[model samples]
Target: PPNGAFRGFGAPQTIFAVERHMDRLAEAIGMEPIELRKKNLLGVGSTMPTGQVLTGSVGVEECVRWALEDSDYEAKRRTLGLANKPVGGRKVRGIGASVFLHGAGFTGSGEDRLKGAVELDLLKDGHVRVRSSSTDIGQGTETVFRQIAAEGAGVPFENVSFAIPSTAHVPDSGPTVASRTVMIVGSIVGHAAKELGERVCKEQEAGGGSFAEASNRLIEREGPVVAHRRYGHPAGVKFDDATYTGTAYPAYAWACDVAEVEVDLDTFEVDLLGFWSAVDVGRAIHPVLCRGQLDGGALQSIGWALCEEVQWKDGRIVNPRMTTYIVPTALDAPPFHTHLVEEAYEHGPGGAKGIGELPMDGGAPALAAAIEHATGIVFDRIPMTPERL
Candidate 1:
């Protein structure tokens, strides 16, 4: 089967391996797993294998610490036992956590080559419109762009509008993927809006009139007032695409997830009791929307960790429908508690980093770790069905 891109790209699968290894290492050394994790966390000065030195906004440690504290992880671990133990006749409890990072925007030279661009159209009524081929796809792309445009234009948020992205009407700002809508494209939108705002202010100074009146005059005289901007890598940031090295992404969002689970020995069913997540998303432009992203993405991760799977038979898919291929509904989701850690990235719009996919990278490994804590059985494969258990 041909592999295509999905949420988190391949980050979740890689994170599961790394996090599970952390647990095994802790057990081998007879140290607290959380302590071991904290001791090895990357900080601002740490360098990646790609030759990129993390110069700022390295918040993995904070994410881990806050996730632990907010989840009362130590207390839960003590109650659940550091090592596997029988809690009762039919059930056992366990707590596990995973900390990881997700890079914002495209990888390596993706942004460099694409050069996502945005154009701000100054409407005749002193309003501004964002023109870019970046679709919203229900992730609040337009809403966010509007907020950024308004701020950049020094106008009311209501005065800024977003065109329904069309290639004919807007510049090709690249596809709406890699969680780049708000980070990369948004930054471009801000730049264009700022330029437009500067023109309006300049007109106001020369014509001796109100800001809105100057904007109207400029639009009437110049016909169409527009400001265009394009995305560029931060100064000195470089990547070698051929060798797959150096500054893979402009910025990275950090996250930690702690999951508590109860295993029913009689039925071999794993039930998640609670889940807590802490993410360092640079800055959240909209707190509610940010939380919504985390909640939704974490739920998807939880589904992937437990029940979501496709069945194959011979050379064809067996369960291709939702009914046969099971998934978690609202009733099945565990209580979720999400927290945001804001360590502003200097170049991002409102210091915001990508939040859309970060939540998808941690839950699976965290759930697996919890199950390991409960049963003392290290199941290598996912979907940990009763038959496998």
Candidate 2:
């Protein structure tokens, strides 16, 4: 399949492979996979391949501990051992868990180098509009941006409007990928709004009038009260482009996915029963929206793990249309519970971090782990179709 930015970007696919390996390793060594993972887990103060220290809000350990408790993992694992009994003929159950850390923004020095910018304008209609080139591709980009802008500017959310994404009207807040829209770009928007708010208040104080009156006065006199900001690294942030060193991400989003699977022995049909995701996205600007991201990513990851396959006819994708291609629907998606753990990124807007693809990082791994447990099979590749089984 041609690669593009999906919900978890590259994470779901990558972790699908890693987590499968984790389960295989655990079985080989005769230990519970969770115990093995816990021993090797990296938490706060751990260093990365780039040698950057995880200094704040690291929550992977909490995610593992909580997911295990919430899922009744140990007891469930014991019951799966009963699959050999005849009461559950021709079917086997497996529970698997996976954990991963996803960088919230660009890989390294990306924000510093990109120098993304944003603008907030006090409109003539007593409303505010934010101008940034972050497009909404069904990932709640516009809604989340508006939320941050409204809260940061201290204005009513209804008073804020989302502008169509265009370079002519909006500034370059960089691309909408790499899960950067909320943390890196939204932070820029928040900073710009904060600056705009301060300017408006300063005017109100000097002119001895209400906020609206002062805002109008400032606009009329100044030709438009516009606040603009270019991205600047929060103090002490630095990276080396030449060496691939230094902070890979300004903040990391951590998650753990626990999956339960039931396999049909006769048909090799893999059915996902339940999935739970625990994530520390710093904080959620909109809890409902955060859950939406988590569910959507998990469902897609499930498809990627067990069902999706793109046949090629010559150079074209055979499944070019949804009519021919297979994708998961509401009926196919399992019941997924999302647990948000807030440690709060100090640099993020309203203390909320980016989770655009964070949920994507762990699902495949967990699913593959569960599949392995059920079938006693260690398949190396995905799209674990019936034929492959």
Number of the top candidate by TM-score?
1
Q: What are the runs in model 1 whose C-alpha is more than 4 Å off?
A: 1-3, 81-88
> What is the C-alpha lDDT profile of model 2 across 28-132, one tens digit per residue?
999999899999998778899898998888888888888888888888887783355357588888888888978888877777778898889987544678998
Where does candidate 2 clash, by residue pair? none
Q: Can you write out model 1's per-residue Cα lDDT over 295-378, one digit (the tens) per residue?
A: 889998988888888888798888888899887888988999988999999999989998788899999889888888888878
Candidate 2 lands at a TM-score of: 0.94
Q: Give the runs in model 2 whose Cα sits over 4 Å from its true position.
A: 1-3, 7-9, 81-88, 313-316
Q: Provide the lowest-lDDT 10-residue window in model 2.
A: 79-88
Q: Write down the TM-score of every candidate.
A: 0.96, 0.94
